[model samples]
Target: MARRGKKKGRPVSGWVVLDKPVGMGSTEAVAKVKWLFNAEKAGHAGTLDPLASGMLPIALGEATKTVPYVQDGAKIYRFTVAWGEERSTDDLEGQATKNSDKRPARAEVEALLPAYTGVIMQTPPQFSAIKIAGERAYDLARGGAVVDIPAREVEIGRLEIVEHSPERTLFEIECGKGTYVRSLARDMGRDLGCFGHVADLRRMEVDPFTADDFVTIAELETARFGEAGRGKPSSDGQAPQEEIRLPDRFEDIDALLVDTVVALDCLPQVSVSDDTASRIRLGNSVVIRGRDAPVEAEEACATARGRLVAIGAIEQGMFKPKRVFGG
Candidate 1:
C-alpha cells in the first residue's frame, strides 16, 4: 500500500486593509503581513508617514497586479494643529522653530480655511523624501545643506474644523493624492496669523479604501493568529482571514480586515470558452475572434493587442503575454 498526500488549498490572493497604528512605518507593517502569508508578491497602495495612523491597503499575490488602479485614487485624513507654534518637520515630532505670544482668533482661522480649500500651490518640505539632483532632499537637509524647494500646485478638496481648544485645533481633511496634511496644517497656521504645526495625524481614506473598511493592527493580530475566529491560518503557521468587511465605527481597532482576495473592477473581463481556457494554461495571452473591448474603457486600456494595455487570449495555438498581473 502507498501513502497519499493531502490535498493542497486554492492559491491565496486579494487585498488587506490595515488600520495602520501610530508609531510604526508603512514599510515595516507591509513586511510583517508579507512574512505572515509568505506570498511570492505583495505591495501597498499608499505611503503613510511613521508619525501618522490610518487606513493602508496592502495588495497580495494577483492583487499586486492591480496596484496601479488603486494607487492613483484620492485620499483623506484627519489631523491636529497646535496654535502659536511651528516645527521644522511640519509635525509634533519635529523641533520647534517658532512660537507666538498670543493665540490667533478662532474666527480668523475659520476665515482662512476657505483660502486653503480648492486648488493651491504648496512647497514640499526639504526634510522630506523628495529627490533632487540625484539625492534625497531630506539627506541634503540632514547633511546640513540648504536646498530651495519650489512650490507646486495641489488641491485641498475640503478643510473643516473638528474641534478647537485654547492651545490646539483639530481638523478633518479630504484631498487628492500627493497632498501633504502636515504642510496644510503648517500653512493654515501661517494663513491664520499665528505659528502652527501638526500635533497629530491619521489617514481616513485612500480612494477605494476607506477608514470605514479599515482594521487596526491589533485586530489583525487576533484574526490572523488566534483561535477559531482566527479565520484560516496559513500553512506557514500564520493564520489566514476571510473576507474583510467595513466596520460600523471608524475607531474600532479590532474589526475584521476586508477580504484578502484581489478583484479587478472597472476593467474588461472575458470568460474564456472551455477549449480556449485549456490552451492558454501553458502561460500565454489568448486572442479570440468576435470580441469587442468595452467602449467606456480608459485611454490606456484601449490599445490594440500587444500594446501592454491588452491582456489574456492567445493568437493561434500560443498565448501572448503582455502584462503579467500576478507578482
Candidate 2:
C-alpha cells in the first residue's frame, strides 16, 4: 500500500479566542485563523451565527481533540430584543412574520423570567442547523417550506434584564450548551403577548473563556503585517520609503494562544511522572501516585513536565488514557 502523504502546514496547537465580528460566519473565521497560523488542523468549540458577535474559541492542531469539552461548557450572551414584531428567522436578518401593537412593559418581562430560568423546552428557529430527515432545517426554511421542529430541553442558568425600553430590551443570559438566545427572545415575546425578535446578539462567555481573552481580526491582521516592515525608513524617498516584506516564519504573527491544557481547566488535573507519561503516550493505563491524587474521577487530565499528556478518567487509582495529546 502506498504511504499516506504528510499533511501540509505547521503542527501548531492551542486555542485562539476570537472576538468574531458580525457578518462573518463561524466556518470562515476558523479557516482564516488556520491560514494565519498555517496550522495543520483547526476547529471551533461552538458555532456563532453570522449576525452575532463575540468570543468564538478556535482550536488548532492537537487542540481539536478537546473541542467537545469546550463546546459543552456554559455560555453567556448579551442581546437586545426588538418588540412589536417577530421575524421569520427570529433575528434582524429575516422578514417580519408576526406583528403586534401591544408592547411589553418592563414589569411584564420581569414577571415572566422565572418561567424561563430553569430547564425548559425550546424550539429552535426555522433557520437553524437542526437536521430534519438528513437535511438542514435552514435549507428547508430557505426553500419556503415550513417544517415542524420539536422542542428540546435546554438549561438557562441565569436570565436577567440589563436595560429595557418600550421599543427594545437588552438582556444578559448565562446558559448551558444548546441554548439558543434567538429562541429565548421569541418565546419571551410570545409569553408577554408582544411579538419580538433579536435585534442584536453578543456572546460574552464560553465557560473557561470570556471577553478578556478575545483577539479581534484587526489585531491578527496587524500582527501578520506589522512586523514585516523593518521599522526603518529607506534612504531614498521612493520605493515606498521603507523596507517591507512578507513574514519569514509563522511566529512572525504573535497572536495570543491559550495553552491546550487550559481548555480542560474545569476538570481535575493529575501530575504524573515521566514513567507514567510514557505509558499514557502508548495509550496505556498507569497507576497514579501521591496520596493527594484522586482515586477516581469522571473526567481528568494528566500532565507531565508542564505539558499535557492525556485526558481520561481515573479508575481505581489508575489513569487510563482516552485521548492523548500529541503536542
Give the per-residue Cα lDDT of candidate 1 at 307. Answer: 18
Specify the poorest-scoring 10-residue window by lDDT in model 1. Answer: 299-308
| Residue clash pairs of candidate 2 | none
lDDT assessment of candidate 1: 0.65
lDDT of every predicted structure (CA atoms): 0.65, 0.87
Model 1 lDDT, residue 104, Cα? 69
lDDT at 8 for candidate 1?
A: 38
Write model 1 residue lDDT over 1-327, tens digit each, in one string.
988875333244567787877877778777766654444566898878888888888876656766777777777888988888888888877788888876866777788888888998888876787788889888998888887887878888899888888688888888876687777878877776687888889888777766567665555545544533334333333344665332232222223434332233334444445445444444544554444533232222212321122243343433354444322
For model 2, the superposed segments whose C-alpha errors exceed 4 Å read: 227-246, 252-255
lDDT of 1 at 233: 32
Candidate with top lDDT is 2
lDDT of 2 by residue, 1-327 (tens): 999999977888999999998988898888887766767889999999999999999999899998998999999999999999999999999998999999888999999999999899999999999999999999999999998999999999999999999999999999999998899889999988898999999999998987888897667656755644333222221124445554666564544888899899899999988877888999999999997999999889999987899999999999998999873
Q: What TM-score would each prediction reach against the true structure?
A: 0.73, 0.92
